[model samples]
Structure formats: structure tokens, C-alpha cells
Target chain A: MRELEERIKNDGQVLGEDVLKVDNFLNHQVDPQLMYHMGEEFHRLFQDKKITKILTVESSGIAPAVMAGLIFQVPVVFARKHKSLTLKNDLYTAKVYSFTKKVSNEISISKKFLSSDDHVLIIDDFLANGQAVQGLMEIIDAADATLEGVGIVIEKTFQKGRQLLDENGVEVQSLARIKAFENGQVVFVDEDQD
Target chain B: MRELEERIKNDGQVLGEDVLKVDNFLNHQVDPQLMYHMGEEFHRLFQDKKITKILTVESSGIAPAVMAGLIFQVPVVFARKHKSLTLKNDLYTAKVYSFTKKVSNEISISKKFLSSDDHVLIIDDFLANGQAVQGLMEIIDAADATLEGVGIVIEKTFQKGRQLLDENGVEVQSLARIKAFENGQVVFVDEDQD
Candidate 1:
């Protein structure tokens, strides 16, 4: 977690007050070494929980989720943004609003992948408005599964994403927590959270 | 390699004559244990190459690429299907045609990630017509970088993907090579390729 926080401080770009760009390591251009370390940390944090599966959305979350799944040696189920021909017909779908994209999109997971006995751990790159997290939780709920926790690589706490998940009674763990941005400088939360 | 071929034969679905669905373990729901083994196999295949980076497109291709990157202890730069706030301004972009989606979408990678000095290994989940791999090769060409080879989890040799990559003189190593479907059964090509 310290490595991630340090990387964010050194490489992350602050676009005004609302956006923090971490393409150098987290999202677009990934640092696989750092990514695996973060995944190991997530596994260490959630080792006590009975996690049968790992859940995440497409694009950004897949890498970290894959790493987490590898560490836990569990199956990972990602909700597709669209109906691809490769996916089966039976699915559990949920509607999610993207605060970053400014578009409401539907995300779904094949019903065959998830079921009533699963204890799921949701992972993603960024947690802003927490809409994606809510959507994943809905899919898990639809499968009659238990939500173990949510693991995020980077979290923007100023956006109140954590508050929303907290109100929903979801335990969230983030590698790097951004308290806020001031005059293009990033302000990170306490290191103890890591 | 035999394990991967076995997984494909067991879990992979043949949809009519056009699509092969391996969502049970490859795309929709990922088996991290098998995925890590596949990554290890890629590591063994490309062990001689001096790869400084692992490159692939976002979403499905991301998992295997990340796994391979972890194996090499190098950076993994995934091309973005849709630009996010995390992406930087300086980028190397290429147009990719998706046969499944039947659309031409552009994938971009930040210029800061890949350099002419870096040797890249392109990795992907499925290779049908090689459009995604072709587009990634174009990105490598645009950056004036060196391409070590390509590592694919599964390759449908019955399609034109291998032919296209062969024509381009790009070395491709696929874990499982599907020759054809005979009466709803999957037939693999010569095992010598593995």
C-alpha cells in the first residue's frame, strides 16, 4: 500500500479539483509489479473472509481483479458492459451510472458464473461516485450471494464514494486514498489506512 | 499447453459455425489458477526474448497481459478501448476493427509508456482475424518500437488470424490451437505448434 501511495504521489496527475489521473501505473498504462503488490495486500486484508469469487467490471478493474484472483486462487467474474456474442444468454444484469463518462450503462454477469453460495470480493481501479461498486453489488445480490468486501486501488474520498458504500454496509479497502486536491497538488489520506 | 487445450475442449462452447465461447474460464468468468499457469507457459515460451514491456488492448486482453507482465516483472501497458480521465494527452493510437462487434474502434496507449528502446510482447485472449493484434502491432510500429512476439491464450487457426500474423511475420504462440468443429466437437490442430 505504501508503494501504491508513493507511486500515486510521484506519478498521478491532478486535473483541477475533481479528477486524479493515475494512467502511469493504475489504469491505462499499468505497472504490473506494483499491481501484484497491491493485489497481494488486498488478499492479505481479506484473507479472513470466506471469498469464493472475485467480481469486477470491464476495462480498468480486470487487471487488479485478475491479480487478486490469482493470489486467492479463486474464480473471477467480470460484468460485461454489453451483450457480446461470446457470453451466454443467461445473465444477471444491473444498471450503473458513470460519473466520469456521464452515461448510464448496463453491466451484466453470466448467471452460470455466480450463484447463491458465493462470497464475493469486488475490485476496481477507481472509486469516485461509487456507482460501479453499487452496480457490482447489485449483481452479487441478484445472484443471491454474499458481499464480502470491496477492494479498490485508488479511492477519491472527497467525492463521498466511501460514505455511500459505508451506508450500504459494505467494507471497503483502498490502497491509495486521496483526501483532496489543492491547486493541482494531491492530498492523500492517513497511511494507517493502507 | 495440454491443460489449456483440455480446458478449451471441456468448457469452450461452439456457437453455430462462427463463434466459440470460452466465457466459462477465459472471458466472462476467469479461472485464475489456470490463467496463472497459462501466464507461466507464456513466460516459458518467450523466455529467450528481451521483453521490457507487455502490451494488449483493454477489457478481456488485460488479464492475460497483466499476468504475463507479472511473470516478466515488467510493465504492462494496455490500450484503452475508451479514453478515461486517467489517460495522458501524449499517446500512440491505432484503429482496430472488431469482427464480433462489427465496428472499427480506436485503441490508444500513452507515449510515455512504450519507447523505441523497449521490446514489447503483445498478448491477447482470442485471435480470430487478428484485427486487435494487428492494431496493436500498428501501435508498436507507430512508436518505432521493437516487437518481440505475440502470446495468445487461444487461437482459432481455422480463421484468418494466424494467416494475417504470419503474413506480417509476427511470431505467435498460442496455448490452444483450434483446427475445426466436427459435428459440434472441437478439433485441435497439430500439437506440434504448442
Candidate 2:
């Protein structure tokens, strides 16, 4: 977590009041070693839980989720943002509104992949408004699967996302928690404060 | 390679004459151990290429690309299919046509990540029509980066993708090469023939 926080401070770009762009390392251009470490951290965080499967959204979440899947020795299923031509049967779908893009996209997973017997841990890159996590939770509810926990690479603590997840009583772990952005710099939440 | 071939024959679904659905492991529901092995295989195949960066498209490609990045100890950059709000500057763009989905997506990569000095290896989940790889190659060309080779998890030898790469004089290494799908069975390209 210290490594991730340091990486964010060194490489993360602060655009405006709330936007923290980690395209340099975490999202667009990925640091696989960092991802691997995050995976190990997630595994350590949720090793006590009975996690049968790891779920995440497509694109950004796949790397960390896959790495976590490797550490956990479980299968990772990523919800497709765009419905492909072949993906048209027994799907568990949920609508996720992206505050940044200002668009509502339907995220879906094959029903064949998830069921009541599976305990799911959701992994994602950024946890901002918690819309994506909520959508995945909805899909998990639809499949009658148990939501084990949520693992995030970078979390904006000042945002409503963490509060929302806390209200839902969902166990959450994030490597880097941003307190705010000031003068084009990222201010991380102190360890004691967390 | 034999392990990958066996996995394809067992879990891979033959939807039609050409479509081989590997959503169980390689794409949607990913097995990270398998991905790790594939990454090791790719490293073994292209270790001498002096790869500085690994390139791939988002979503499905992230898993394998990150795994290979970890093995090779390099950075992995994924081309963004959908441009987010913050991604507005110094961009290299390419249009990719998805034959299966019957759609064209403009993929972009930031100028900050790639450069002429970097040697790139493109990794992907599947190689069929080679549109995605071609699109990535275009971006690499725009940046004046050197493309060392391509590493594919699964390649349909009958498809035009392999031939296209061959014609372009690009080195390609596919872990599992399928000759054809006959009666819902995957027939791999013989090792001797390859």
C-alpha cells in the first residue's frame, strides 16, 4: 500500500478539484509489478473470506482482478461494458452511470459464470462515485451470489463512493486513498486517519 | 503449448464454423494461472527481442499483457477503445473494425507512453482477422516505436490474421493454433507442421 501511494504521488496527475488521472501507471499504462503487489495485498486482506470467484468490469479492472485471481487461485469474470454479438444469452446485467463520461452503460456478465454457490470479490481500478461497484453488486444480487468484498487500486476518500460502500456494510480495501487534490497535487489520506 | 491446446479442446466452445468462444479462460472468465503460464511462454519466445514495453488493446488483452509485462519486467500500455473525458491531448489514434461485432472503434494511445526508443511487443487474447493488432501497430508506427513481435494466446491458422502478419514480415508466436473446428471439436495445427 505504501508503494502504491508513493507511485501515485510520483506519477499520478491531478487535473481539477476531484479528478486524479493515473493513466500513466495504474490504468492506461500499467505497472504489472504494482498490480502483482496489489493482488498479493488483496489476497492477504481477504484470505479469511470464502471467495469462490473474483468479479470486475472490463478494461481497467481485468489486470488487477486477473492478478488477484492468480494469487487467490480462483477464476475472474469481467463484466463486459459493450455487449458483443456473441454475448446474448442468460446474462446478469446492470446499469452503471459514469460521472466522468456522463453516460449510462449496461454492464453484463454471463449467467453461466455466476451462481448462488459462488462467493464473489469485486476488484476495480478506481472507486469514485461507486456507480460501477454498485452495478457489479446488482449483478451479484441477480445471480444470488454472496458479495465477499471489494478491492480497489486507488480510492477517492473524499468522494461518496467509500461512504456508500460503508453504508452497505461491504468490506472494502484500497491501496491508495486520496484525501483531496490541492494545487495540482495529490494529497493522500494519512495511515492513522484511515 | 500442449496445456493450452488441451484447455482449448476441453473448455473452448465452437459456436459456429469459425467462432471459438474461449470466454471460460482466456477472455471473460479468466484463469490467472493459465495466463501466467502464457506469459512465461511469451517471454520464452520473445526474450531476445529487447522488449521495453508491451502493447495490447483493452479489456481482454489486459490480463495476458500484464502477465507478460511482469515476466519481462517492462511497462504495459493498453490502447483505449473509448476515450474518457480526461484523455484529451497528444494522441495517436487508429480505427479498428471488429469483424465479429460488425463495428468500428477508434482506439487511441497517449504520446506520453510510447516513443521511438522503446521496443514494443503486442500481446492479445485472440488473433483472427488481425484488425486489433493492426490498429495497435498503427499506433506504434505513429509513435515511431519499434514493434519486435506479437504474442497471441490463441490463433486460428485458417483465418487471414496470421497470413496478414506473415505478409507484413512480423514475428508471431501463438500458444494455441487451431487448424479448424470440426463437429464442435477443435483441431489444433500440428506442431510439426507449424
Candidate 3:
């Protein structure tokens, strides 16, 4: 977590009041070495949980999820953001509003992949409005599966995402929690959130 | 390669005349163990190329690319299929026509992530028409980087993907190539493709 926090402060670019671009290492272009470390951290956090599967949305989250899955020795089920053509009639669909994109998109997972017996660990690159996390939770709910916990790389603590999940009783852990991005410097929450 | 070949024969489902679905292990719900094995195979194939990075398009391809990147100790840069406000202006974009979805979508990579000095390995889940591969290659070209090679987990040999790549003189290696899909069986090519 210190490594991630350090990387964010050193390499993360603050574009505006809201956008913290860590694309150079976190999302768009991934540092696989750091990625493995992050995966190992997730594995340590969820070491005791019955995490049969790791779930994430496509594009950015898949990398960390794959890394964590490898460390945890569990399968990964990534929800496709792109529209599907071979989809059967049965699906667990949820509409998620991306606060970053400022648009809403429907994310779904096939019913066949998840079920009542499985416990899923949800992962993502960033946690902002918590829409993507909520959508993944919805899919898990629809499948009658247990929501094991949520793992995030970077979290915006100023946002309502953490507060919302806290009120809902979902166990959420973020590697680096941003207190503020004022004056072109990132301030951390300073709490060890393992 | 035998492990991957066995996974295909065991879990892969034939949809119709030509469509083979390996969602049980490859795409929809990925088996991380099998995916790791596939990554090992890809690493074994492209070991001598000195692959600086792994390039892939998003959604289904992200997982395999991440696995491969982890195995090879490189970064993974995925082409974003949907453009967002956060990535409006800083991108090297290309258009790709999805044969399955039957629509053209813009796939873009942040220009900051790729550069001329990089040697990339383009990895994907399936290579059907090879349009997506061409789109990714075009983005790499825009960056003035070179494609070290292309590694696909499964390639439909009956499709035009292999021929087009061979015509372009790009080296390709697919773990399992589907020669035919008939009578609910997914047939493998004569050998592990080189």
C-alpha cells in the first residue's frame, strides 16, 4: 500500500479538480511488477475469505483482478462493458452511471458464470461514485452469490463512494485513499487500510 | 500447449457452424489457472523477442494480456473501446468493425502510454476477422512502435484472420486453432500454430 501511495504521489497527474490521471502506471499502462505486488496485497487481505472467484469490469480493472486472481488461485469473471452478441436470454444486468464518463451504461454477467454457491471478490482500478462497484454487487445479488468484499487500487475519499458502501455494510478496502488533490499535490488518508 | 488444447476440447462449446465458445475458461468466466498456463505458453513462444510491453484491446482481451504481461514482466496497455471525458483529447485512435456485433467502434489508446521505443506483443482472446488486431497495430504504428509478435489464445482457423496476418508478414502463434466446429465438437488444427 505504501508503494502504491508513493507511486500515486510521484507519478499521478492532477488534471483538474476531480481527475487524477495515474494512467501511466495504474490503469491504461500497467506496471506488472507493481501489479503483482498489489495482487499479493489483495490476496493477503482476503486470505481467509471463501473467495471462489474475483469479479471486475472490463478494460482497466481486469489487470489487477487477473493479478489478484493469480495470487489467490481463483478464477476471474470480468463483466463485459462492450455489448454482447452471443448472450443467452438469462442474464444478471445492472445499470451503472460512470461519474468520470458522465454517462450511464449497462453492465451484465451471464447467469451461468455466477450462482448461489459462489463467493465473489470485486475489484476495480478506482472507486469514485461507486457506480461500477454497485453494479458488480447487483450482479452478485442477482446470482444469489455472497459478496465477499471489495478491493480497490485508489479511492477518492472525498467522494460519497466510501460513505455509501459503509452505510450499506459492504466491506471495502482501498490501497490509497485520496484526501484531496488541492494545489497539485495528492494528500492521503494516512490510515493503514489493510 | 497440451494443457490448453485439453481445456478447449473439454470445456469449449461449439455454438454453430464456426463459432466456438470457451467462456468457461477463456472469455466470459476465465479460469485463472488455465489462463496462467496460456500466459506461460505465450511467454515460451515470444521469449526471445524481448517484448517490452503487451498491447491488447479491452473487454475480453484485457485478462489474457494482463496474464501474459505478468508472466513476461512487462507493462500491459489496453486499447479503450469507449472514449470517456477523462480521455477525450489524449489518444491515438482507430476504428474496428466487430464481426460478431456487426458494428464499427472506436478503439483508442492514450498517446502518453505508448512510444516509438517500445516493442509490443499484441495479445487477444480470439482472432476471427483480424480487424481488431489491425486496429491495434494501427495504434502501435501511430506511436511509431513495432509489433514484436501477436499471441492469441484461440484462433478460428476457418476464418480469414490467419491468412490476413500471414499476408501482412506478422508472426502469429495461437495456443489452440479451431479447424472446424461440427457435431458439437471443436476441432483443433493439425499442430500448435507457429
What DockQ do the predictions score, one after another?
0.81, 0.89, 0.74
**Could you give candidate 1's per-residue lDDT for residues A39-155 as a string of tens digits?**
899999999999999999987888889889989989998888863344446878888887777788889888888999999999999998999899898888888999999999889
Question: Candidate 3 chain B: minimum summed lDDT over ten consecutive residues — where?
Answer: B80-89
Kindly report, for each predicted structure in the order presented, the TM-score of its chain A compared with the true chain A.
Answer: 0.93, 0.94, 0.94
What interface-residue Cα RMSD does candidate 3 give after superposition? Answer: 1.3
Cα error of candidate 2 at position B9, Å: 0.5
For model 1, the superposed segments whose C-alpha errors exceed 4 Å read A83-89, A191-194, B82-89, B191-194
lDDT by residue for model 2 (B1-194), tens:
98899898789899988999989997789999999999999999998889999999988899999999999999999998853334557888888998998988889988999999999999999999999999999999989999999999999999999999999999999998888888988888895464
Model 2 / residue B127 / CA error / Å: 1.3
Candidate 3 off by > 4 Å: A82-88, A191-194, B83-89, B191-194
State TM-scores per candidate: 0.93, 0.95, 0.93
Which segments of candidate 2 are over 4 A away from where they belong?
A: A83-89, A191-194, B83-89, B191-194
Clashes of each: 0, 0, 0
Residues A14-43 of candidate 3 have per-residue lDDT tens digits of 988988989888778888779889999998
* Cα lDDT tens digits for candidate 3, B75-126: 8888878533355587898889988878888888888788999999999989
Global local distance difference test of model 2: 0.91
TM-score of the first chain of model 3? 0.94
Better of 1 and 2 by lDDT: 2
Positional deviation of residue A193's Cα in model 2 after best superposition, in angstroms: 7.5
